[model samples]
Target: MGGPEQQVFHPNANIVRKAHCSSMEQYRQMHARSLERPDEFWGEIAEQFHWEAPVKSNFFSYNFDINKGPISIKWMEEASTNICFNLLDVNIQKGLGDKVAFYWEGNDPEDYTRVTYKKLLEHVCKFANVLKSHGVEKGDRVAIYMPMVLELVVTMLACSRIGAVHSIVFGGFSADSLAERMHDCRAKILVTADGVWRGDKLLHLKEICDTALDKCSKIGHNVEKCIVVSHLTRLSNAHTQKTPGMKPPVHKTPFTPGRDLWWDDEMKGASNFCYPTWVDAEDPLFMLYTSGSTGKPKGVLHTTAGYLLYAATTFKYVFDYHPGDTYWCTADIGWITGHTYVVYGPLANGATSVMFEGTPFYPHNGRYWEVIEKYKINLFYTAPTAIRALMKFGDEPVKKFNMSSLRVLGSVGEPINPEAWLWYYRLVGQNKCSIVDTFWQTETGGHVLTPLPGCTPMKPGSATFPFFGVQPELLDENGKIIRGPGEGYLVFSKPWPGMMRTLFGNHDRFETTYFKKFPGYYCTGDGARRDEEGYLWVTGRMDDMLNVSGHLLSTAEVESALVEHPDVAEAAVVSHPHAVKGECLYCFITPNEGVHFSTTLVAELRKKVREKIGPFASPEVVQHAPGLPKTRSGKIMRRVLRKVALNDRDVGDTSTLADEGIVEALFSNRPPEASKLLKAC
Candidate 1:
């Protein structure tokens, strides 16, 4: 993680209205079905999607009792079909050749583009050829380092079309991050662009790629070549050329290079595409790494059949997608949310999804609203952090849009505050839509716990219910499952189709990270509680579980209690070392405007947490601040806060931090060590 160079100013998003949902009863039947006769329920659901070869047995088998762990897994075990066939092969024959798969919205609202199934297939075909020309093959991993663009999507589908395994590294990742992933996968081909533009700034992606390739043992030797799209490959030369067709000699000279090939040239005469190679249903389609701090990024391998089945089913259910509807998930494809929802999920269901290539607020604060207006986007899915940021600007810019097309709203990446949830529900959704705050991870494939638009009643801050096949349980420390809504470790007591097979080449780590935590149960890295109403609310990661005098406490609970207060806009709580107690509680608070900050607000917040939860949950210290540190996805970087709070004095691994400047701005105190250390020590 880069230190001191990553913080960016963010504005809070306005959220209004509130999502209301009912009893967990009707959802219970589905759970009962998933448990008792899983084959019947899930097998029927899987039938809705296109499968090349139909299996005779509905479910081969399913089981997961806490003692057994992975409570249930339905294997259409005998079925053999490529996921690409489901997305591309079947759609063509139905004459949905012109069906729009992706509607792209760039930072510049004017730069709109659409890729139909026919066009997407052609690009995938051509790119598959390009990959083959460069020596890519089935099982030989390929690395794609590109931005949120059409070529990136094309590269992914191409990998699946040719049965090649792709490992996507998000464009914003540093060379060290990219190099680590490249070495882990030992990819044969590297797909990258020279550079990319984010709002007014240009990112030197190709330069970073070249630098990463130098250190990557796999790419340095095994990598055939790097495929560079002719983007402004460097920040320095971004504005050198006036426009693409302009008569600029120096720019034209480097537009296409000997080692770097232009996408325009690569697609010409590269066939309307070769036939998609069919493989075993279990054959890995791609390996999308998770957000790891260091070492090797967890190469979460997703296979074709199980992955497709889960994404398609969960996408349709969680968002309540209607045929011919426009869905927008403003996430980069490098992450799981982007991989499954942005691409595979919508495409499998033959729905149109908008792929945004820039920040929500770029050219103007109204960028997001403008896209919603222009696209008439029906279902808009984004992160909680983004919503909180937009809340700062109030409802002014959002009023500029005629967002009648928006029918459903979604929150992913992290648990959204009820206040921000209400804002999105009111201002953006206009009370007519459903705010389905979903919870799942890269390892889980699709949304495991979420509200299904018309099916489940949504609780403002709650993730609501488990997806069709998932069986969720809240467990206490002694390996006993907690029945009522109480804070504890979150466990998926069964198997999910989209679940990661292993942490590529590291089975032991996989077993240790997930399974070992709770024998027989797939320990979700998060801690959650089922409310009295049975609505599930996620606190944060398991490691985020704090110990106060040996009592397990979650930062989520305290933060949630703080946000429940009218004046408190946001909060981040972490453990600070105490001589007597192993770790004491400390919180950084952000108050809403028009509310004067003083000792009174801090006292009020502390009392709120104490009265609402318990006196033991009281914060030892509460400091009101302008803002708290967060990730790009909106998750509070409490780890950073913990280090500072404990008087470590060192600002740790700031590269992962969305606001590095906030570190210095927040921590005025100093530790007896060199400044800006990358480790916790």
Candidate 2:
């Protein structure tokens, strides 16, 4: 019932690309053929790419049963391929070299750059040679910690060209978070930048990298070299732009003479010619991590051939991308969405993808519309959070710009709220572009459930149907499969090409976390409902996690961060309803016996969480409690805290609590008092 006024919107023939199937019947036919004859369907799709060798089978003999034995899922087992060739070389070989590959618009309007397939290939080859010169080889892991820039794209492709598995930690992550990821992967080489522009603030990325490297070295991760890109012109006097109100920082990045190298210096010495390294289909392409329920994040491992095929296929079908059309997905390279959609998918399809290194409301509220008009972007993919943020500025800013070039619109990261969905549908799309509310996760390399813009009929809040080769199911609390038209936990019953191979260095955790829950099916950890006609509506996460502004943040991770503060004895973190971010974190802390709770203490604790996790995980409400409601076994009653955070009068079943008095004590000092305290801080 929470779904937006359910209205069925069919495909608009005027906006839909002609190459895509125009009806649901064609989609159903293709889906049926994909499930019934996978080899034939996927084989035909694979033939569109340049594979070094043909795949003999779609999948090897592997059972999905977790209880019976270990689940071994492998796709394209006998094929040999290279992702760099498909993304870069193939387009160049087909005479699309001169066509624009990436139109990079920097944070400041004065800064801009464009790269063609030919130029991109040359940069990739040069970087690949640079990596080889530094002893990087196949199976070696390289760590990239950079902001949204063209160099990040080159680094990813260069790693792929040389068969090195690259792990890109988002630039916004804390040093501790970056160190943990680097240590987990034991990266041989590290790539970073001196600084990055984020609105008015310049993030000193080199300082963070230095701190992470210090920890990595201590943990026995012997990173051979660090390549630092001097990205900020303000760091040097000669290139600095003197503005009336802009004040640059005085911090200078230190360089280690032998161990560290300049990006340009290394590129200058390296030759712009390197062959793509052919790898087996099952070889790992990249490793990405997701916020796990536990304190530690899980490193999701995605393989080469299957992931590439799935990414390209979904990009082509979901957006109905054509040869000359331009596509733009405004996501950073840190997340899986950016890795799959922004880089691999669009490039593999040889589409002109916009790479904007700024926010939607940067210089103005119509920045996105301005770019759409400037580049004539045919497809615009973004998050629901961004849409909601823009909605706050009203429709006038959007009306001022021309968005006529947009043919398809997309929503990702989290489920699109009904109100935000309608605004995006009417204002940005002008009822002409089809809105694809995509639903997937970091574990799934590409979108699994979404509307094929040209084919499926879109409902405002629903992610229309499953992509080809995906079989979804709804399971009740007792693990019984719910039939049609019901609400339950979401689970996948079949193997998909883009699925994660395992959690890096923790296959046991992967098997237990995802497989052990449902035995045979992969647990999505999300609650979902299917309409009578079988359209899926993601009902948010069922775990102790919150999708705050489309970024996944775990409650346990924040709790861990809060407790790391010496004054905090214990903490309970929960999500409360938020208008814009979907959910915001609220913390209830029981200080150490003698420690006092003050506004300064609250500010320090918030900073602690920001440094320990990331800036996004900082709790909006930090309530000081004498003690948290806990059971005899010492489990904090998070539900009671959650109820208090939401100001709900009905506190469910306090009879089982070891300390019932703590509930009243906690609620008496809830967000109203906490908000006053936070405001003072």
Candidate 3:
């Protein structure tokens, strides 16, 4: 399937007026040098940070070819440094101590906090001491499950400060999911909050943690201590009387006398001058679990020096971030985007960052716009799913806010359709700000393929170019590399600094999953195409590709075509078994607000798909969906959709979904004929 190339959007003269890399020529030269002389290029970047002991030997070594040995990658092997120290102490020594490290926006717009670098250090150090007092030491695992608050960031830094590997579970995850992750990491201590507020609902986080801990105990993995942050309780206590239409104050939090310790109580007696624990560059910094194809989650492990250096460098160049720019990335600290961008990246560059603790639609559909206006945010990074969700409400919510302060906008998590990209550019960016559509994964710690805001010209639906030092190549099904303007599997010919070293506690699995597919290349597990201009457009995952009567069609391509229709807010496409065609496209579409779904609309959508990607790509079944099943982070749960489309009774793990009821609703709404087909099979 093919369509006309999208019109390219160049950087606005005003937007790139003060960019670090002003022209495409400069970016090309720098990227070429990064690949030609990696050691020199990376060494210079490494010097920007504070290293306890610099590398005495080779800067990096790798073995992507399994025939050589176990698949491995090591960067700055002979160096020693503390990621927290570089992110905090180094910046403080550079006279950024009084600068605002984080502008924390709470769930309620009225509640906010600004934390200076000096104050952040004090809090992180004190919390580090608290972890030490509870027997947490170097290499120990600490599980953090808390809401989006200043304390959560403090806990992450604290773990890094004392060389304890932290695993942050998203607050919205079910207790069983939390327990599975905690058990996988064999966490010794658990950090959580009393409760959290999402929109108008109050979720008891402590109760969830208690349940997770109980599940962990049953699995023979016991947490020695649980540190509880009384965030909501403190808010409730401060406001003596309840406000009209607000939930009642949360007064009591269940506690296990010996194992549970209040966060404030531990901080009161802890010292604020705990020294950083230096470790090898290759040492594990954090472990984040991501869903695997086999129904089990795999822990993607990242190291210290390489991960930090990559995050900082990419943050500086990708967003064209200036020194005093107030950057905001609307991602919870639980995800890799938050870990690299929100905490490590901007801070490492001494840039002011915004941390928000609620959904984009919470309080109102305009919450995100309000936060941007309130903070005068310069660089804003968010997901395409969120952008699409906000698009359903029309432009009124965003138009009311002053987005003139924005210089650069970014889209992550998934490939953005042209329609949503145009809406974000026309309304949110005001047609002046550049949109950098980044393409990477949890396995890759930072951006791999993305347009440089000030350098590469933007394409609405394409990632445009690879980041510095990323060598991207497309390969056919037989593993032979496809030269130019062809669609195939996307893979990297070489390793980047931010690439995950291995799966925690399972090195063999890591090798087999990523390296086994292409032998010498790192298989990205996604299909992509390079246009005539060399801009790469990522089609969805390989598994999402459908084969119909010898014709191959990408679900992302069809979904993008479906979303291009004005009435469709979002669309998810999955393949269903068909006796005649081998497989057929099954689409779940959510219409825009106030738009009625009917046969006319469905026919219009199918026509749009056929026009965009040819007749073979037309979806066989079109189901009206009130809402697509998404994770708390705004990623469409396509697996659940696939299961529901097939009318499978056992829809695997809906725990990570934002609303499990959406799955049930989808199943209930499945066409009667489709249900019959499943039963007949």
Best by lDDT: 3
- Which candidate achieves the best TM-score against the true structure? 3
- 491-517, model 1: which lDDT tens digit per residue? 987786787776788766777777776
Model 3 lDDT, full chain set: 0.90
Candidate 1 overall lDDT versus native: 0.74
Decide which is better by TM-score, 1 or 2: 1
Poorly placed runs, candidate 2 (over 4 Å): 16-19, 57-61, 234-251, 544-681
lDDT string for model 3 (1-681, tens) is 453237778899986778888898998899899888889989999989888999998999889998788998999999999999998998999999999999988888877879999999999999999999988999999999999899998999999999999999999898998999999999999999999888787888999899999999999899999999999977775454546556655468899999999999999999999999999999999999998888689999999999998999999999998887999999988999999889998998999999998889878999999999999999999999999999999989998999999999999998888888999888999999999999999899999999887778888889988888899999999999999798999999888899899999999899999999889999999999998888899997998888988888888888889998889999999998887788888899999989999989989998998889888877778988989999888989887888888877688667768788898889888876676555544
**What is the per-residue lDDT of model 2 for residues 1-681, given as tens digits with 9 covering 90 to 100?**
222437888888875558486788888998888888777777778888888987764554455677888777787899899999999999898999999999998887667779999999999999999999999999999999998889999999999998999999877777878888999998999999999877665678898888888988898786889998888853344235545455655666878878889998999978999999999998988998777777688989999988988999999999989898999999888888899999999999999999978877668878988889988999999986577556656689899989988889999987775666788889999988889999999898899899998788888778879999888999987899999898778999888788898899888898988888888899999888788898887876777668888877656446656665657656778887666667888888877656788888899999987887678777889998887775422335677887888666588656435457888887778757555533443
How many residue pairs clash in all the candidates, one count each?
A: 32, 0, 0
Candidate order, TM-score descending: 3, 1, 2
Clashing pairs in 2: none
